[model samples]
Target: MAEPDWDRMMQAAQAGDADSYRRLLGEVGAWLRRYYHRRLPPAMVDDAVQDTLLAVHEKRHTYDPARPFGAWLGAIARYKWIDRLRAMKSHPSVELDENLPVPGHEEAVSSAVSLERLLAELKPAQADVIRLVKLQGFSIMEASHRTGQTMSLVKVNIHRGLARLSAMIRSRNDAG
Candidate 1:
């Protein structure tokens, strides 16, 4: 199948074409689903998709016709993902069945795969620092010593690496 001209469709939607607008939303929603499917927890995926769509709808007028539609949509989508993360952190879910054993092997592997994919997008230095500090539970000082980087550099790399990973997640067209 041929790819839709998202830029034109969005422009037409902005100009009050109801049919084009509907088509645009449909396509965008599908794209968002692919974008979030692996990134979010399974239970959170539907809510995240709906939240991102709502954000896109509310911010539709802010989209620039001269810019790439994917980039614009990605920016909004990334913000929505961050918002969801923040909300989840602030309101951690309660365990419904404390007596039930949590089966973590599959979840751990899935998370690791996703982490590696995201890490592959970063610079070697950044990726190394993140892996040592974030994934391996190394202190900044320990990561610095192991990586032969200054403590401050280790901290900086971790921060930049995570930020880049988050920003690039929405922009990548790997959903296919």
Candidate 2:
């Protein structure tokens, strides 16, 4: 049998081929394990591998067929690996035992939840794009990585979602 093609499998997976997606993820999991094995302890390697696979599963839609699939996978793997390293840190600059009350913290949290609800009113794709790009300050590529949206799709969703939100706010203000 011929060797499996990564890009072709990814494209198929994007087109809703469950078998292809499963095969691709299985291969990716193996690849991630190998990539992280040397960098992480034996206990941590599995977590890193799982993390990268989950990231890939989430962002598979963003894979541009024109780009090399390995590179895309590598980017996700690197990001996950770095996250693991950060999580493994034991040294802390400040202890968390100090529970100091900050002014408006409750208000800020409430407002943040309200904003999230407003975002949820958009289409799923639009809401995700807006939350990642506008609220989370993620770059287009980073948003693409997280949400698996093409660059154009991400931009268009943000534009349309923002416009809709503006109209909604205007209506609310006019009514008030």
Report how far off residue 122 is in candidate 2 (Å).
47
Instruction: Report the C-alpha displacement of residue 74, candidate 2, in angstroms.
Output: 0.4
Candidate 2 lDDT over residue span 1-176, tens digit each: 11249889999999999999899888877766556544443445566787778788888888998977877787677666556544533211112212223543444445456557667888999889776765555677888888989988888887787666655543452210
> What lDDT is reached at residue 166 by model 2?
57
lDDT of 2 at 99: 24
lDDT of 1 by residue, 1-176 (tens): 11358889989989999899898889888877666655654455568889988888788899998878877887777677766544533332312223223554454456457768878889999989877765555677888889899998987777677677766764565423
Candidate 2 Cα deviation (angstroms), residue 48: 0.9
- In the order shown, what is each candidate's alpha-carbon RMSD? 7.3, 19.2
**Minimal lDDT window, size 10, model 2:** 91-100
Model 2 residue runs over 4 Å out of place are: 1-4, 90-176
